[model samples]
Target: MSETSKVVLVTGATGGIGSAVCLRLANSGYSLILAARDISKLQAACAALDRPGLPSHRWISVDMSSDASIASFSHELATDGTVLDGVVLMPPQMRPTGDCQPPADMWRQLFQSNFIGPLELLKSAISTMRPDPSQGRGAKIVIISAITSVQALGNYATSNVLRCAWLAQAKTLAFAMGERGIHVNTLSLGGTLTPDYVASIDLRATKAGVTFSERLAEETLNIPLRKYGRPEEVALAVEVLLSPFSDHMTGVNLLHDGGFTRAY
Candidate 1:
């Protein structure tokens, strides 16, 4: 199958990393289905990816935290007979501060957004993804997670737990779905200088009585690369995973952490 004929659904499509992935895939000739909670932002994201002569992209409003919303979205995809060639699952990046041990409700919320909802969507998407005999592989599923999954982050206890669960689930699915030709993998990222991360740096700087540049430097001190990742760089990684380059890879958690994770 040609890249132009492939359809990729990117959840959280309007976010920094998500938007970058969408643009990269679009430029590589893949049709995109941009999914997010906000209709206006989804429209804007879709519009931004629109090229003059390329295949037009589509958008859908989906809140990954809501079970009803996920069910509805899944039904819509099935009913519409949407054949997905790839799915990029970018769950909500919720960094809840304050308790090291959060409440049960907090854990539930985190699990739903980070694990349960994405799992359901992947199940639904897998049904729509038929392996192309000509290509000898089925669809690709890329779960976007944080480096905190492998390394703990202060005040992000819930994320620390759930992201690990997400990675385990991806590995399990990769094994379970290998026979079906569906490649399941994950991208665990480090401090990427997205708008969100920049704002976070600004807040940390204020609290620490330092400038943004100083705080940013402190954040990258432990990383061997001594720099945070760029959204465009992440997009390129997503593209490679989705392309034929990853046909032999599965059940792998590829870390884009700039050498932040030292454990073997």
Candidate 2:
């Protein structure tokens, strides 16, 4: 299939990494279905892309924290019947972590957005993808997960647990959909210079009575590469995972950390 005819769905489309991934895919000629919670941010993202002459890629409001919103988004996609060639699932960032455990209600909300909602959308999306040789190239699914999915982080207990669950979910989907020609995989990221990562460092800087840059530099020392990754750098990996280049790879977590994670 031609690039312009292919459709890709991206959740959390307004975020730092997510937006970069969208831009990369747009430049590669894929029609995008941008999904996120805030309508204004979504509009701003679409405007920044500026695809004036060609078919305008769409933006749909989606609250991963709410089942109704996810269902609505899925219903719209199913109704449109746009043959999805790629699906990128980037769950919304979680609240800052602390030493104390959060309330049970908070955990439920976190799981709903980080785990359940995306899974539901995946189910709907699979139905709209090319399933076999007769239907053209197979569809690809990329779930953006954190490095904590493999490693344990005491501070980010909720994320550590939920992201691990998502990894398993992606692997299961990979097997379930492999015969149908859908590639399901997860991209595990380490520290990137995204707004969320920067804000987290800034908070630590404030509490430690140090400059944000200094804190950021100190944090980078833990990474073997001695720097936080740029959003575009991570987006490149997303491109690879979604492209035909990764046709042989599936049911795996491709780590994009700058060597911060030591585990193999």
Best by TM-score: 1
Q: Provide the lDDT at 225 for model 2.
A: 90
For all predicted structures, in order, the TM-scores are 0.94, 0.92
Worst 10 residues of 1 by lDDT: 130-139
Clashes of each: 0, 0
* Candidate 1 lDDT, 29-75, residue by residue in tens: 89989998999999888888888778888987888888999999999
Q: At residue 255, give the lDDT of candidate 2.
A: 82
The pairs that clash in candidate 2 are none
lDDT of 1: 0.87
In model 2, where do residues sit more than 4 Å from their true spots?
1-4, 52-55, 99-101, 134-136
Per-residue lDDT for 33 in model 1? 91
Model 2, range 8-113, lDDT digits (tens) per residue? Answer: 8999899999899989888877778899989999998987875655445889898877889888988898898788889999888876486457789988888888
